[model samples]
Target chain A: MLLGVNHKTAPVEIRERLAFSNDPGVPYRELKAIPGCEEFTFLSTCNRVEVLFVSSKGDETERKVRDFLFAGSMSYDEAGKYVYLYKGEEAIQHLFRVGASLDSMVVGEPQILGQLKDAYRTSSDQSCTGVILNRLLHKAFSVAKRVRTETAIGSSAVSISYAAVELAKKIFGNLKGKRAMLAGAGEMAELAAQHLLNQGIAEVVVANRTFERAVNLARCFNGKPLAFEELVPELAHVDILISSTGAPDLILHKEDVKPIMKKRRNRPLFLIDIAVPRDLDSKLNDLDNVYLYGIDDLNNVIDINKSERDKEAVRAERIVTEEVLKFMLWLGSMEVTPTIVALREQAQEICRDEISRTLANCKDLSPKDQKSIEKMASAISNKLMHHPILFLKGEDAPEDQRRKLAIFRKMFSLDSVSRQDNGESD
Target chain B: MGDLLFKGTFLLYLLSTIIYSVFFFSQNKTVRKTARMFLLGAGIFHTIYLIFRYFEAGHTPLTSNHDIVSFFSWAMAWGFLSFRWRYQIKNFGSFVSILITLQLIVAAMSSSEVRELQPELQNILFPIHASIIITAIAFLAMAFCGAIMYLLQERELKSKRFGFFFSRLPSLDALDTLNHHCLSIGFPLLTLGMITGLIWSKQVFGSFWSWDPKETYSLITWLLYAAILHQRFTVGWRGRRIAFFTIIGFVVSLITFWVPSYHFTGL
Candidate 1:
């Protein structure tokens, strides 16, 4: 079962109230104290707080887990309004979706997968999860990997800084040996400059109105500090310039950049003007080899990228569904009833095949004789399957029951057909 | 045998062109590899065809309309392949293969009859001048392809449409570098080809300079490339302006090839 309150269902205030500390021990201690709770793993991220557990006492354990999560934040009825509960197959599907980042606030972002792996690691390390969760979590990790490889969900840029980097790549082909200049100390400019540096841009030059701020920002990037008045001269040296100054008017003009292109030997220049009242003139885009994108333009590119990711997300979701079905099949096989049914079906199939082949050879036989032969074959098959079924149904610990079910399925080769079926579907 | 070889070469080039076009749209890596293999095969077959024609005609095969245009196509194929060896420009082969196939179609349509060598044109300098000039034109043709891609990519970037050409074409910087690389090699060869032609003219026509239509147009093309190269180095003219200049220079060079001259009566 899975119980959680995420950004979609809870406000930040309510989410913070239930948010656990970073120390895994604290949450595990509280989670362990919940009555009737079996093996469990607790995941707390900025966007969600979820508890994945395996328990026979379903309703009681769910109530207790909810109380543990709420913990004086609200009444039980009010807490139910914020929390979502998924049992059985739904719970498994939810876990797979989360592991694959399909349930992320920013869909297809990679952080959720790492966070889930960390959560699973903590739970397994603390001996809080048993056979079911161990298998389930591993399956979830593989499902996430499959989704990542089979789709392009994580390839497109969805954030502003990433959009800038994508555009810069389109202009420069590669960022190595290229230089970027941060025209102001604004947060957005700093972020874009950082992204460029991460892309292996060779140097960064920070220029702001106040020399001290430029020096501080430059130090953060291990870059050069330049005076704001020298920005135009620096344009000749840099391939990308990000400006987000608080100026009411444009700081750079077409007239200013027209000459710089000549000085730079007509090398391509990418200008990102993220300021509200744009720092760079719109006409800068008119110059040959000069690409100027204002805030709106970058947002437009991000919007397109987001749509592209959404299309890929659909493919990712399909992969998740496939993996969920496969996991569900495995989960069903863990149960004694399914294993016994599969064993009987396999035995009957073998009997039918043998009887039909024998009847085909003795075509002179009467219908009554053929019917007698089919009855004898089924009786023998039933007698053969009786012991294995009894052994699977024997009363034992839940862990031993799982082991018996696995052994029974393997002995009869019952799951082999279903595995082949899955492969054929793929 | 020569006709059969030429037909085989044309078919191979056509097949490679078709595969390249398919790869351009699909962007499948396997398809791209297959397309490149077919193109390489076509290049080899074209080389064999040219050698066979040279042996059959018992003279350099750069004399007839069919031979000259086919040589032009062969030079383009090798030029493109050589560039691929150095650097990869996205979807470059697709565009270049289209040109090669079209040139072959022109060669196929024209007369392929082997012409008797003109008595005066029998000098060794004749073949040298023709082959060098055609090879130089081949590099300029690649520059022409790069310039068109540069313009298309520049339009996409400037318009911020992010449409079909945006992701498919190479970067503006890469395309510009392509133009620069091709021009740097082509212009010098073009100058040398022109100088050899002048020397050949002095030996065969008793004059160092002539005002033939082909000569006049060749000078114009050379001057245009010279101006473009000069501006690129000193004045920093690049991107759209350089792209346009390259296109114009290539068109003028094509005219230089087609204009009636004492040297090429096969047309």
Candidate 2:
């Protein structure tokens, strides 16, 4: 079963209230104390908090998990409005989708897969997952890999800072030796600068009205701090400039940039003006070798990329669906009763076939003789199957039982026959 | 033998161009490697063809229309290869191979008949002057290709609509640097070629400053490049404006070489 609140189902306020801490032990101890919670994994990221659990008392354990999630924050009735609960096949499908990143806020981002892997690792370290979850999570990982390789889900940029980095690559070809300057030290600017640094931009320079704030932001990036008044002079040296200052009017103008272009010998410059009222003049884009993108322009590019990503998402979702069916079949086969039934059915079919063939070969045999032969064949087949059935029915830990059932099915090739039967029934 | 070698060289260049075009779109590393090998083979075959033509013609092979154009293509092939040895510009070989193949096609279409050297053109200065000028034009041709690529890429960046050429082309900075490198070498060779030609003109024609059509056009092209180089050094004129000027200089130089006139014999 899966119970969770994601970006789509819960607003930030509710998600923040229900978010779990980074310490794996806290959730492990608290959730393990529930009356019927058999196994569970807690996953908490900025956008969602989910608990995937196995339980025998389904509704009762689900109630406790929900109450535990909302404890000290809200009543169970109020919290129910923000959470979604899935059971059985729906829960399996939901976990597959999450692992494949289809359920992410940005559907095709690659981080969710890593986050899911980290959560699974922590859960297994705490001895929180059993055989079912171990197999399910492994299946989810392979499904994610299939979606990644078969679809173009994670190729395009869907975020603002990513868009900026893409544009920088187009202009500079390589960002290894390039420098970026943040004019205002705003959140958006800082994010863009961070992305630039990640792309291997050699240095970052931060300048703000408050020199102290500039120093702090510079320390975070290990970049130089400059006074706000020196942003224009600094522009001559840097390849990219991101400005999100609170200034009401434009800080840099076309006239101001023309001289800088001469000073820099006309190296390409990429300017990002993310400020609301606009810090850089619109005419800066008119200068030779200068590329200026405002917030709206970057958003427009991101919108285009988002649509492209959405087109790829449709194909990824199909892969997830196909994988979910395969996983569900595997999950169904994990039951010992089905394996035993299928094994016995196969032995009886083979015994009946041999007895009929033997009866046909001995044309002169009496009806009583033929019946005896059939009874003897049935007794021999039962004797041959008795030890295997006993092994399958032996009392063992659930994990060991699942392992034995898997091995027994493989030994007899029972799953293939069952699959053929399924195909015929369909 | 020379004709067969020339044909083989032409075929090699065509094959190289085809492979390079494939690599441009596919961006596969092994495909690029194969394309470079084909290009290297073509360059070597062209060199052999040039040597064979010199032996068969009983003089320097750059005297005829076909020989001059073929030599121009050969120079371009080597110039591009030499650049590849030093630095890599993205998808640069694709464009340059096209240019070299197109020049070879033009050379093949013209008459390959070898003619006796003219009385005035039989001096040592003839081979020296013609080879230098053709070599300089090869580098400028590379600049022309770089300029066109720059314009295509800059338009994509400016319009904010990234189409086919956006990722396939090199960065604006790289393209601009290409133009600078080509010009830095090409401009000085051009100056040297002109000085050698002037000294030869005085020796062969009795006057150095006569305004023949080729001379006038070469002067015009030279002045244009000089101005561009001057502006680039002093006032930092680059990118779009320099690309435009480099393109114009190459066209004018081509006209100077191709337009038939009476003053330059056998050209």
Task: Tell me, by lDDT, which candidate is best.
Answer: 2
| Model 2 DockQ, alpha carbons vs. true complex | 0.64
Q: How good is model 1 by TM-score?
A: 0.67
Error of 2 at A203 (Å): 8.6
Worst 10 residues of 2 chain A by lDDT: A417-426
lDDT of 1 by residue, B90-208 (tens): 99999999999999999999988877888877899989998999999999999999999999988988999888888889988899999999999899999999999999999988998
Screening candidate 1 with a backbone cut-off below 3 angstroms (N, C-alpha, C), the clashing residue pairs are: none
> iRMS for all predictions?
1.1, 1.4
TM-score of each: 0.67, 0.74
- How accurate locally, in lDDT, is each candidate? 0.87, 0.88
Assess the local accuracy of residue A196 in candidate 2 as a C-alpha lDDT between 0 and 100.
78
Give candidate 1's error at residue A217 in angstroms.
Answer: 4.3
Clashes of 1: 0
